[model samples]
Target: QKEVEQDPGPLSVPEGAIVSLNCTYSNSAFQYFMWYRQYSRKGPELLMYTYSSGNKEDGRFTAQVDKSSKYISLFIRDSQPSDSATYLCAMLLYGGATNKLIFGTGTLLAVQP
Candidate 1:
């Protein structure tokens, strides 16, 4: 099984709507969960990061993680057309000589004006 799994959704929403993105992982060793946004032809940028199991909010974005259930989520409020992009869920396994990072397939989102 993949360490992290996310629905590759071409999800469409209207302006000002709230958007929810989710991912599930099989690795209990993951210590850091992050959400990244990637625009076409651009590199993925970190949007949110959460350590352990908890929630973190930044501006209109909220990221949540549940280590017990091995699930994570990202919520965007007041969606805008500019928010259209691919959202990737990533997890970091910290330990050993080197840390490891794994990413989901990514979910595509489009917000209409």
Candidate 2:
């Protein structure tokens, strides 16, 4: 089974809305979870990173992880037009010599003006 599962959505919302993006994992070994935002024709940029499990908030964004449930989520508050992008959820396990990020199929979001 795929380690991580995220809905590959073309989710649309109006400006100033609160958006919730989510990902679920099947692997219990994942220790590092991250959320990345990628603009069209641009590279993915890290938005939030969590070690182990906890809730992390920065500015208008918040990331939550529940290791016991193997679920992680990202919340965008006061969503703006600039926030329209593809959001990726990634996880890392430290066993391999060269650990690589396992990313979910990105979810596309559009915030209308």
Candidate 3:
């Protein structure tokens, strides 16, 4: 089974709506979790970063991690059309010589005006 599973959503929402995206993992060794937003044909930029398990909120975006359940989620408040992008969830396992981020299949988000 894949270490991480995400909804790979073309999740559609109205501009000003709240959007929630998530991923579940089978691996419990992950020590770091992150959320990245990538525009079409562009590289992803870090949106949120958390160590272990916790919730971190930034502007309209919130990221949460549950180590016990091996689940993570990203919440976007007041969605905008410009927010349309692919959201990626990534994690790092501790034993590697260097942290190699394992990423999920991105979830595509579209905010319609």
Q: Show the lowest summed lDDT stretch of 10 residues, model 3.
A: 91-100
After superposition, the stretches of candidate 2 with alpha carbons farther than 4 Å from their true spots are none
Arrange candidates, best lDDT first. 2, 1, 3
Per-residue CA lDDT of candidate 1, range 12-105, in tens?
Answer: 9999999999999998888899999999999999888999688888999999999899999999999999999999999988877798779999
CA error at residue 107 for candidate 3, angstroms = 0.3
Model 2 over residues 3-107: C-alpha lDDT tens digits? 999988989999999999999999887879999999999999999999867899999999999999999999999999999999999998767797879999999
Record all residue pairs in model 1 with backbone atoms less than 3 Å apart, i.e. clashing: none
The Cα local distance difference test for each model comes to 0.93, 0.94, 0.91
Cα-based TM-score, every candidate: 0.95, 0.95, 0.94
Give the number of the best model, judged by lDDT. Answer: 2
Residue 96 shift from truth in candidate 2, angstroms: 6.1
Residue 18 in model 2: lDDT: 99
lDDT of 1: 0.93
TM-score of candidate 3 against the unseen true structure: 0.94
